[model samples]
Target: MTALEIKEYIQKNGKIPYVLESIGCSNIVYHDNKDYYSCSNAVGGDCNNPAAINIRNNKYLNYRNYTRGVEYDDGKDLISLVQYNKNIDFANAMKYLHKLLGLKNLYKVKEEKKKPDDSWFVFSRFVVKRRKCVVNDFDPMSEDILNDFVPYIHIDLFREGIIKRTIKKFGLGYSYRWRRTIFPIRYWLDGTLMGYNARSSIENCSEFGISKYFITPGMRKEINIYGLWENYKDIQKAGYIVIFEAEKSVLKRDSRMDPTGGAIEGHVLSDEQVRIILGIGVEEVIIAMDNDVPIEEVWNMCEKFYGLRKVSYIRDKWKLLGPKDSPADAPNKIYNFLFKWRIPYDESKHREYLKSLKKNS
Candidate 1:
């Protein structure tokens, strides 16, 4: 019979037993005074019980959960019922149901399109070739490496006391061959090393065609927060965690995580990362991005954590400090501002802070 004819016959007579017989289903049983159809694909020669459908109530029973049946609407089609019971894609399930009913190619149905093969898209085709620097690979946590490079690091970027404390606390190291300071990125507190962020220590390195910052290739920076592995326990202890842009800011604040620079604009927190923060039982998240970052960019970063409702943006608090200054640049001023406002853990505070800053400026 054609698909249209079978559909019309089922609608008119409601002969579910006959329909099951036509679809090659056998060994039907009646339980709870209800007709139960056997699954056509039942294995072996033993048909223990009816675990396919309950025609009396227009319900479909999954073989996995025979006791609990799913009821269908009045006008639900056979293809959808089969798809639901079989747990297969729409097109393939529809085709299987249609063929089982002895329906020919009478109806015109759109065929599923094949996806394009992405195996041809390789890294070499799109990656730009550049001059490779010979980096000395050493254990990031080795005492010898730490002792070798720590002496060369100067406290020119941040204060002497803060730098020394941060280096010891975060396992910060340096690479003499690369002429860059090393910041180890870990998965959790003392967890596996994911990668490293290397910042050039040489003066005028950018002018000499040396990139100031270099992230390890294949590192999933988009989903990671720098310093989170080390400071998660401290964050739980403090009841809240501060957010910053640069790694140095995380060190300067001593209880914060940086999304590793440039993340404020393009790489905001991912959903998995948010769940990680929530799992840590952090009550509030305060963002203190660079003072030079645009207000719109700060808003974009704030929007990433909008659903959390415990995030507060303190970018406006740093306005009076100066242009392009970060929390690390003036730690005392930022600290004093945070202490004075006592920024509440409210989402609306961000808007209020922005409004007050604009009004005063």
Candidate 2:
């Protein structure tokens, strides 16, 4: 079974109490009214706080260490809980979780039933017209609310080479309680406050099975393109906009004074996003999604801008990026290479590229 498959299986079949015990959480106490169990802190040390750890919904876990105040695991998976308490990476944690579940070796475990392929192209076609479902008016949040968060930059982001100027320019904040770097999201057209995108600050957070981003509830991210509120004028002036998969990529480009927009999701662009991008009146669009996205799917994303505007996409054909690294995720040289050599989207060329990928694989 794959890591995702094993994680899903654990969620479906694993029990909360057993998982807690396996991870060294003693004195587990269930709260009947709240539907959560309090246990000895396996995370961040107990300090004799018998019920320091709280497990809720059998999936999410939080702990309040005496010194740390309160911290929640962003990953919100059973394996993430294990990973935290055991001080192990995701793969080792998965192996431990499999043992606790009495499952076979991680690789040897077999699925009882075959699962459907959930690739982006499989559903993107159907959801093309569903873009009208976006809600226009959201309850506005005060900009002053950002004052409640510290302007502390996480070490991981610093390691990513995000400097103070770019961080301040975007109004990024750090929440000690949630342990996430906060991105205040606003309306793309008018800069009206919409909500916030809280991202985990932990190093290798996604690999450790932590939820990478947690947007405010009911915030429709797909309808809004990040950086538009800040860079629309620049985008229009440049006559082109580079579209990245995440906000960090946009920030990376911004530090270089390169105007960009972020889909804030994956490679798939929503119709509303297309509308927003086209509305920017840029003559050209550059798609710079992560390296792992299938070539055909990248072309499908480019298909959204066909004919109306010049659309190109950056791919690591020169072997500059890691398997899943985005163009902006790398140093300037790697990023410059991919961006400078972006291929103009053409149906025939897209097909040829697809054939080459298949042949090479």
Candidate 3:
């Protein structure tokens, strides 16, 4: 009869006849691919169309099907579209049935449909209107380095002589990256375990690891902020972050990857993502860079981060970087560049940033 009625019928009889098509009921699609409609964003077939906002947005599109969010759901079967073969966890069941009934599709556009253009460089080349873009090239050294390794896991950080020499001096579980870098990813308030930071140990290497990605894991939007998992005290005393290209650069006493990235690294942080990070309550940012890029690039980056707060750069921090420029290369020097600079932020700069974003967008 209606979207809500169809849901009720299915809930009551465990099935709804084909007449449910008006309210948008179609077969549940399930496959092993990662694109499985396993989340609310992947809400299945009867998804609402903004153009036809008054109608139900079923997971299924009649003539033009979007396979992006299809998956099987026969009574909570996440992997196959069979009815009630077995009981599944609440989370798994919700993920599966959400795709089957396609309840979540009404809220928004599909992710792939909203993706930015494939043209242009992956991160910073495009304009983002909100705050300065924190998106940067994965590896922005002046030149390219050999990057031919990919492992789901790594063990070099724990080799025999390496950990011993450092552990005896720094303490057990002291964070380090690459060959000789270490940073503060430990407890801040009492005994709470904050994550550790480390950098790769190689000279002129653009990427320290298999991927030069930023990760503040164990953080879910419902639970925690990205950069503020714990150790807010250190973050508070510091006033704001000296946003570097990598996670390794947070601690003044730690090593940061891409210290020379400056503005070239896409240091602009969006107001939405920033508001969440700042909601943890830090004031502003002091972007640090390495000698790998030009000063104008850094200024361009600052232009993107317009609305949040003031941003400044460390003068000679990029110059101090060693051959590899990872935290493991020269831990202390990395910290020197981060703490030495601070700038105030104003929102006006965001106008050009937003305009550029819209044009390129």
The candidate scoring highest on TM-score is 2
Q: What are the runs in model 2 whose C-alpha is more than 4 Å off?
A: 1-135, 203-210, 350-361
Candidate 3 yields a Cα-based lDDT of 0.34
Off by over 4 Å in 1: 1-152, 158-161, 255-267, 342-361
Ranking of all candidate structures by their lDDT, best first:
2, 1, 3
Write model 3 residue lDDT over 220-331, tens digit each, in one string: 2222122342324445566665555443232222212222221112334443333233233345656555545454555565664444445665545445556435332345
Cα lDDT of model 1 overall? 0.50
Reference-based lDDT, residue 201, model 3: 43
Query: Which has the greatest lDDT?
Result: 2
Angstrom error of the Cα, residue 209, model 2: value is: 7.5
Worst 10 residues of 3 by lDDT: 137-146
TM-score of each: 0.51, 0.57, 0.33
- Alpha-carbon lDDT, every model: 0.50, 0.68, 0.34
Query: Which model is ahead, 2 or 3, in terms of lDDT?
Result: 2
TM-score, predicted candidate 1 vs. hidden true structure: 0.51
In candidate 1, what residue range of length 10 has the lowest lDDT sum? 130-139
lDDT of 3 at 77: 23
Local error of candidate 3 at residue 8 (angstroms): 26
